[model samples]
Target: MEAQARAILEKHHDNFLEDGNAVPAPARRVVGNFNVDDAKPVARRFRSIRPEHLRKAYDQLEKLFQTELIEYSHSEWASPIVIRMKKNGGDIRTCIDYRIAIQLIKLTHYPLPLIDDLLIGFESVLWVLSLAMAKRLWAVPMTLWAKHISVLICLLRHFQWTKMLLGLKNAPPICQQMLVNCLWSFVRLPASEAAQMDVDGLAFLGIDVGDSAEEDLSTLIEGMTVFGRNVPSSPQLNSVRGERPYICDIGYGTETWEQLCVDLDRRLYRLRYWGTSVSLLKNKFGKKRFSHEIEADRIQAQSKIAEGVIDLPSPSTLRDVQPFLASLNYYDEFIESLPVIAAVLNKLTDEQIRSGRDLGRAMEALRILKRKTVSTPLLRGPDSQKSFVIIIHANPWAACTVLGQESDGVFIPVHITGRVLHDHKFRYHPAENEVVALIRALRVFRAMLAGTKLIKVYNRYSMLKWICTSRSLEGRCRQLAVCFWKFARFSWMTMVWPQSWELRLPPPRDKLDQNDDNIIQVTGRVIQSPPVRLETLGPRCEGWLMSFDGHAKKSDRWGSAGCILWELLSWDVVQARGSHFADVTVNEAEYHGMIEGSKMALVRGISEMVIVGDSRIAIQQARGLIQCLKPRLRMLLSEFEDQRQEFKSIELVPVKRGFNAAANYLASKI
Candidate 1:
């Protein structure tokens, strides 16, 4: 590759640094009438050049004058020119300020001409143009005639050579070499004026004398239509010119598929299809193909290290103890309660401390870590054709999410990730933190999801509204929102409710009371998974009554919600209360209470219910009597409406605090 690149650069080396030859006058003559108005001359005073660089600048100006590239002018079009240091830091170069001259000239532009109109004029004499160009430049030097003959050559190249090369219908070996050589020599022409040196001053008249015409435009425009993969196979182009040997199958009773296999085997001895095996297939997909059976070597290595650490004698000095602790720390993710169990051993390793432990607690932690790792199930690799589903859980200090896909009628895990939210000053709301979890997970697995369908299954159902509708979030949350928008724009993505039965790997049932650790659960489990709150009712209940209430303290640190259900048949009442640290206002709290109340009713298979709340704003918003202009309130309102879909009818009624006393008392206590 490096040698080929050097050869290509050497081929075009003459096009670079030149002898400052001025382009001939014929190429510069504009072939159009200058009927547009001319502007008055504008002038500026020239600034003093730097004293040290004045001599170098003067020498450069003298070279330009000698080459006739510039002439002395006494017009009022003067502007300051600066001397700039060369890129190699060896010398200074002279530069001109053409701003005043540019301002004084009134530019003329013609309306864009249609290609069909020009093609009509050339339809009768296409061959005449090419022959005329070749005849005119036949006797002149290659470099001298290269510029003046560019317009004629551009027309011939675009109409003749480019068509022959792209269509793949020409006699290949001789024609390809001839056309390639002709185009290669054309690059030595004056490239700087190529774009403006058209047949006429009208640049958009379908005539481009630019280097791009000889180089890139033909390939770009002909890419899919003429030179694409599905073009019919030509023996001259593919077999002879491409240097691929032709293989023929002559057997009498063989099918085409059998003949292909036989020919391949004869030529290569053994035929192998790339990316066919399990390992190769996994690599082609570029996903995490986690499996214990396939990772036996890695597991064996870790097992040996663990056994060695276990058999070693207790360390008397800190140096001897450090290596063992380091080895155990590497496997901390698999260990449960690693920090508390290894606390004494970690203290012993501190540089200034001389104290030590008996290695009893460390041994327990290691044994547990080893056991857990041995029992851990291997996850499958991601499939690009399959849709991706992300299950997320978040809290104030930490967040976790699992990437999985449905396989064999089950949702199997592909990867799991979590991290501590270390930015303390940002103070992300719980919903915002959940959004952070989602964005972090999507970014981590972006490659696997490039053009795939993605579905986000969220624990906090209200978060779906914030992600899909709210446009007012700022700072890190807004950054996350943009990342989501980019992926959402190009891919098939949806935010939907998470079914209760969808959780296959629930959060650890044993860690219900360990809330202070702030450990993010990769699985869908919480602190004492709350049971479904069902309204206790009498037999054959006729109707249902819901009492909704909300609460906010004077300082607004947290908001509380309460809802009570009454079965009218036997006058039985069931009460439920919850709190939201993310909600800032009392009205938000009231909407949250109404949302949860509707959810409880839906879960109990109730068709209709009456929702009674103390906050008039919450009641009016739910009843569509008022619009919630605030972004967060609007999102909460959307969540309430989505939950309303599960019920036949939910009527909202506003009541005074005294009339809704039971639910208000429950909200205040929450």
Candidate 2:
């Protein structure tokens, strides 16, 4: 240990717990505040117990009194007491079940730390320290009202807990919240040490000296004193080896053994400075790896993820999809096609475009992503000091980018990423798509390229010139141009034609059909599907909007159909009509309403029309994207198709029902 650290530890000797129970947290806290939802609390009936166990309960209660952990209580909220033998089988433990009390208390939600993030921090380190705390739950105290509900009755005498206990649902998250608050300042200690040890601290960081007041020591000291008795202790590290866990059994590594000793000393010194002690028996220093380090046996963790060892199931709804992706994101660096898969998920997550036009395509993309994520070749770590080369591909659906560096005259990949495009982006000219892809790649990999200059970009169809010279940018395109120019200025970038064979990575396959393909197999980067173009209207009713709606009851097979068409030039209804259909389904009625409305336009010699309807099935079928499976529906679609030909130009649009209220009102009145 360093002399300074040793002096600090010796100065706060009282905080250290050499043996017996742990010293309480530096301050008292109301941890498990059991706020009841009801005015009166229900006292649960006592559960029957064996005579011998009842005697153990009484003995435990007397010990609680001696320890001042419990006191005589006068409250209607009573809970049944239960006695159980400790794991050692040497002593009995007593506590109230509090099952009913917990139901009455309002729930609290606080996020716990993630294990994958914890493990990723241990990548190149050679040494790690695992520390534990004794009786951590006592770190957060309970309010007086909380104590009233925690009553335990040993037949005659009633008692309540004076300190916080773990029986309530909110206890764990409350403890987590407190732990995060206390450790908020500790993550910067290494940087503080780096500034002193290195010749230039802020040179690489791109910042000036940090404020001394913002640096927190309590985080490190308090962190070493967590992982209380409630968290199972592992005397032998080998015994507790497993996959990732919720609480950090921290094994973050340093590059060398000497660095480990220094970090250990720093922690010890800080813990003593904060008036806390480390349980020598619970901490393990200089360990190879702990339960969470995927790097120790990366293949094992990779196989586990591929084998579905991660706790994820097929999502049944659109809202469940993002979290499912997030669950797999911890290991995304190891997945070759992360950006492409994320793009597919983004389509499902968007609420505005629920047109149901590309549902099957999204599902297929998700499958391709899953199959591609099975394994990947190891990638070189990114070096911020060096310039970077990016190979990019983009289409209407998704964009893929590969970031790499030239090492020993060979192209070495640092990272791969992909993302789905949104509304206006999809309609962008092919050249604009490339510009969008480039802008997204720059933002995604900005961390690795922080200080890098002279970025080299390559694409199948180079759009660097288009981005530079195009003064016709509009809306989304203009925003993308501003972003691109900023990055261009920052990096002094140049665009070059790509030599695909020079890089080791396989080109994205033309079709994403095979399951075992190593690279992200996006559909051909060629613009396979162009954005929908409204049919060109002739002289009559040239710029007009049409709203159509249909009402039908399955029981009676009777409904009314209506449509209203207005000229955009005059804001007046050129045509409005409603008719009843006695023997048609809802889909048929909706199509008939649209067809009747179109006929009125044809009679009025209106050659062009834009039709909007709430029925997705009707609009999709009219456009021939959805095949008609039923014969009656086929005939109605054919009639609608014929009516479509009469107009010089026609456009079919689908929208939510609430937006088509005017047409719907006319339909229901008929």
Name the best candidate (by TM-score): 2
* Candidate 2 residue pairs in backbone clash: 29-141, 125-254, 126-254, 135-229, 183-219, 339-418, 343-420
TM-score of each model, in listed order: 0.27, 0.39
- After superposition, candidate 2 runs with Cα above 4 Å error: 1-27, 30-124, 129-177, 180-251, 254-287, 290-331, 341-378, 381-387, 395-398, 406-410, 420-434, 447-454, 460-481, 486-503, 508-670
Q: Cα deviation in Å at residue 540, candidate 2? A: 45
Can you write out model 1's per-residue Cα lDDT over 510-565, one digit (the tens) per residue?
24214323222222121222221223334565788888888776575578888888
TM-score of 1: 0.27
Model 2, 259-340: lDDT tens per residue? 6665554444333322233555566656665333256455333455466733345455566677767766665655555655
Candidate 1: where are CA atoms >4 Å away?
A: 1-368, 374-377, 393-396, 423-427, 460-472, 475-478, 488-670
